[model samples]
Target: MSVDTIYKVILYPFITESIASLKAMTNLQGTAGDPFIDNVDDFRFKGYAVCSDVTGNLDGVIMMHHYPETAIAIGNSVCEKMFDEKYEHTEITEELSNALAEWGNTIVGRSTDLHGRYSLEYNFSSPYFVHDVSDMAKYLAGVTEVVTVPITVEGVGRYYFNLLVRSVDYQQVGIKREESRGIENTHTTTLETSSKILLVDDSAMIRKALKRYLAQLGYHNVIEADDGASAVTMVASESPDFMFMDVVMGEVNGDEALRQIRAAGSNVPIVMLSSVTDKVLVDKCKDLGISGFIFKPIQADSGAEIIKDYLKIA
Candidate 1:
C-alpha cells in the first residue's frame, strides 16, 4: 500500500479523544526528573510481537511489535492515564499483559473499520504475543508483501505496525521493484579493546542489538543477563569490567541489584539504562553509586565513547 495509506491505517486508531489526551500529557511531562518517564522513545525495535489476523476484503495480519519493556511501559501508561491507576514499575504482570493485548485488539478492530471506506469488509482475530520474531514468522508464511510503519508512543518507545498481505501485487500497492545488491568488502583494522562488558535486560532484541553495536565498535568480550537477579550472579562470577543495566527488570531491579553488588563491596563501574526518569529512582541510583546513566535505544558511537571514556580504553 502507499506509505500514506499505511501510516493512516496504523495511527488512525490511536487518534481518539482518550488516547490523544494521554499523548498530550505524556509530551508535556517530557524526559524530566519524572520516575515514570524512561527512554520510551528510543528509535530501536527491541521487543516482542503481538499479532492479529485481518480477514474479508483485507486478507492479512496486522502485527504490533514492541520490546518487552516497551510493551510494559505502554501498558502502564495506558493504565495510569485511562484507568487512573498507578503502576510503580513496568513489569509484565498478568494484568498488564492482558491490558496490552486488549489495547492491541481495540486498535486492530478500529483500524479495520477504515477499510469500509474502500468498500471492503474486515474482521480481526484476537491479538496474541510471540516471544521471538522467528515464532512470528510461522504465521506470515504465505504473505507475499509487507508494509511496516514505525510509530512512537510517548513514554512507551518505538513500535512497528506491520501489515502482511497475501497474493497482493507490489505494484498495485505502490511498492517498487529494485535489483538486489551484493555486500561490499572493505578492509578495516580492529581497534585495541579489552573491556569485558555485561548487558542486562529482559528483551532479547535489546541484548542482540547492543551486542552487535558493541561488536562493531570492537568491544567483543560482551556477556548478557536477562534480569536483575541474573545480573547480580553474573557480576560475581563474570567479573565484568563494566555493566549496562536496565532499571525496570524482574527478580531484582537495577537499583536493588546494584545495592547487592555494592553491599558485597565489588565496585564494578555500572551504567544504568532506563526509559523511566523518576527523580526518586535517579537519586536512589546515585546513592547506590552508579558510574553513569545512559538512556535506552543506545546510540552505538556515543555509547561506545561513554564506555571507552569510563573504562579508560584509550
Candidate 2:
C-alpha cells in the first residue's frame, strides 16, 4: 500500500460522532496532530494495539494503535452512541473491549476490501487487542517498512494506524490508473425542485456532510433527525421523498425505526447507512422494506448515484 489508500480507509470508519467532535475542537484550538506521517523509527510504547494478519498478494499485519486514554475515550463514545450509556475510563470492561475489537475488525476488513478492488487480494485475521506496545513491536520485528497514520482525537491524545506489508508492484497487480484517483467527485442529477429528503443520524458531522452532499447534487429541501425515534417523527411530518438512515443510534436503532415507520403504512423510499457489515441485520432490513443500503462514511459520488438510481431521479 499506498499512503493515500490507507488514509481513505481510516477516514471513513474511524471518524464517528465523538471523533468528529474532537477533530472540530482540535481545529478550533489549533492543536491538531499532523496528518498521516511515516515515522517507524520513533515508535514508542504507549498504548493499546489491535493486531490482525493480512494474507494474499500483499502479505503482512495491520495494527491500530491508540493511547490508553484515546482507546478508552473512543470506547466510551461508541457505547454511548450505540447503547445510550456513559462509561468512564476506569470502567474498561470486557463488553467495551469486545466492542473495540469489533470496530477494529470492521475498519481492517473494509481496508482490505479497498485493496482487493485494486486487484491486491487480501484477507484479514480476527483482531487481537493488546495493552502493551512491546507485543505489537515483537509481532513486526522482521518487517522493514511500516506506514503510520497519526489521528488526533481532541479529548483523548493521538491514535496511530500502522501497516507493515511486503513490497509489491502496483502495475503488476492490475491496479487501474483511474482507480488510484482516490474519492471521486459527486455527480449532479436533475430532480424536481420540490423534492424533499430526510437525513437521520446521531452524528452532527455526518448529518452535515450528507446535507452538503445533497446540496451539491441539487437537492436542498433536506431535513435532519438525530436518532431513530426522531427520524420516525420526521418521516411522518416531513413526508420526505427519500430518507437516509444510520443503522447505529441511541434508543431506537435504524431497524426499529424502519419497523415502526412501515407498521404505520408509510411507503417512503429509505436507505440504510452503516459502517459495519452484518448479514443478519441487512436481511432484517430488507424484510422491513428498506429500499437500499449505503455504507458509511458515505462517498459523495456513490451516494448521489444511490439516490438517482433508487429514487428514479433524472
Candidate 3:
C-alpha cells in the first residue's frame, strides 16, 4: 500500500537494464538522461514490439500504450536482447516498444515478490503501439503517479521505461493471488507431482505452450482434448490428477466442460486457463466448481505448484 512499495519491487530491474542498454549504445558509463517525472508529454516509440493489455483498473480498465516510433524502437532493441536477430524488431519503434515491454514485465515480477506478503499484485497489460501520447494519456485517469525511468542507450539515443503505478492499500483491494510461501522441499514437491493432467484448449499454440511448460517441469504424462465435449471424455478416461482447461473453444468451452466434469463426478483439480479475465466469465467459472485458475502465458513454476496443491502431492 505504501508508495515506496512500487519502487522497491520494480525500480532496480528497470533501472539496471535500461542503463545497460544505454551504455552499450552510447559507450558511456554515465547516466543517459535525467530520470524525469514525465507529465505524459507527447511520447513516441520506434521499432517492433506491440503493447498488450494486462489487467487491473486504470480507469476501471488496464492497457499498455506505446508511442509508435518509440515503441517500435524499444521493441527492436528488446527483441535483439531477449532473443536472436530473427526476433529483432524491423522498425526502431518496435525495438523500443519490445525493450520497454520486457522491462516492464520483469519489473512487475520483481514487484510481485516484494509486495507478495502485503497482498499487492500487478496485472500487466499488453504493450500497444500508438503514435499519440496525448491520446494514450487519457487512460491514465486514475493513475496517481508514473515514474519515467531514464536510461541512456549507448548509441541508440536516450529513451525511457515507465512504471504507471496506481496505488491502493494492500488490504483494500479485492483480488486473489496464490500464497507466496514455500518449504525447503519446494523443488522436490514440484517435479514429483506427475498426476493426471487435462488439457482443454481449442488453440494448438496455447496448448503447445502449456504442454511445453509442464514438460519442462518434468510432468511428462499429459492428456490433450480440443473441446469441452472431448475434455469431459478425457476427464473420465484419463481421470487426470490435474488439468489446464481453457475458457473459450469451438463446440464447448471451459465453463461447460467444467460443469460436465463436475456432473460426471470428477473432482480432479482443474485450473481455468484463459487469455481474458472478465467478471462475467469468472462468475461462470465460480459457478462451475473450479477452485483454481491461471491466465494465459503461464509463468515458470506456478503451474507446477498449483497442480501439486490440487493433487495433494507429497
Candidate 4:
C-alpha cells in the first residue's frame, strides 16, 4: 500500500530531521532503521518516553521513547553542549528532563515547518515525560495506526520515534479544511532568481526542504554542503551570491565559518539559521555580521522577506 501523504511529507521528514537534530545537538552520529507500522495498541515503551500532542492540519500524538540509560546519556550530551558541563548523570534529573523535552520540541517543531511549505500547517503542545510507560490507551483512544522508526546513536543506545496518526477534527481545529490553495499559497517573488545560493547544514533533509522553498521563489542555482568545513571550502570554490548556514554543525559552526569567510574578504550576504534562542549566541552571531536570522522550523514567508531585503530586490 502506498504511504499516506501525511507520512510521506510531514511524519517521514520529521523522522529524518530528528536524527539530524540529535547529531547536531549532541555531536553524536545517529542512524535510522526501517520504519515499522502497526496498530497503536502495539506501541512499546522501553523505560522512558517524551510525548506531545500535535494539532492543526493533522492531529495525533508524537513521541520519543528511550531506555533509561539512553535518556540519561543523551540528556548528558545536551547538557555538555548547552552548559559546558562535564558531570555525567546516572539517573533522570530536572536538568536532564528539560534537555530531552527541548530536544523533542525541536524535532516536532522542525517537522511542522515542512507542514507550512506543503500547506499543512500544524502546532504541537509542550512535551511531557513518562517512565516505563505501560499504558497509552488513553492517548490512543481514537488513534488507530502507529508508525515507529528505530534510531540508534552508537554508544548512546537506541530510541524510537512513534507517530500515532489520526484524522483531523475540523471542529476542534476551528477552521474549514480545503484542498485548494488560498491567498497564502502564492510564493512568487519579483527578485532576480539567478543568484547562486549556498545551503550549509549537516541534515540532507533540511537542505532539501530549504531548496524547495528557494525554488518556489525562483532560485535554482543552488549548491549544498553537509557541514561547516565543506561550507568554508565551497564559499571559495563556488562563489555563491547568497548563503544560508546552520548554527550547530560538525567541524566548524556557522559563526566560526562566518568569521573565516569574512577573514577571506568575501562579503557575501549570509543568513544564519537555527532553532536556538540563546540571546548570547544570537548576539555573538550579530557580532560576526550575519546578514539576517531565520529561526528553525523556518517560515517560508519570513525567509523570503529576509532574502529580499538583503538582495535589495526593489
Name the candidate that leads on TM-score.
4
Expressed as tens digits, the lDDT of each residue in 215-281 for candidate 1 is 7668889899999889889989999987878776656788899999899888877777664444467
Query: Lowest summed-lDDT stretch of 10 residues in model 3?
Result: 179-188
Question: Candidate 1: which pairs clash?
Answer: 34-277, 34-278, 35-278, 37-276, 37-277, 38-275, 38-276, 39-275, 40-157, 47-67
Instruction: Give me the displacement of residue 86 in model 2, in angstroms.
Output: 2.5
What's the CA RMSD of model 4 in angstroms?
A: 14.9
What TM-scores do the predictions have? 0.42, 0.47, 0.42, 0.52
The models' CA-based lDDT, in order, is: 0.57, 0.61, 0.50, 0.68
Shift of residue 227 alpha carbon in model 4, Å: 34
Model 1, TM vs. native: 0.42
lDDT of residue 114 for candidate 2: 43
Q: After aligning candidate 3 to the native by TM-score, how far in Å is the CA of 219 from where it should be? A: 9.4
Model 1 clashes, total count: 10
**Across residues 1-314, which tens digit of lDDT does each residue of candidate 4 receive?**
22344455445766777787776667577898877786566665677787778887667888778888988998888656544346499998877776776576667555544444444456666456677455665667787677777898988889888777786532111112122111121223343688798999865645765786677677899999988888889999999888889877657888888888888988877777776444566678777766666665433334444445444321
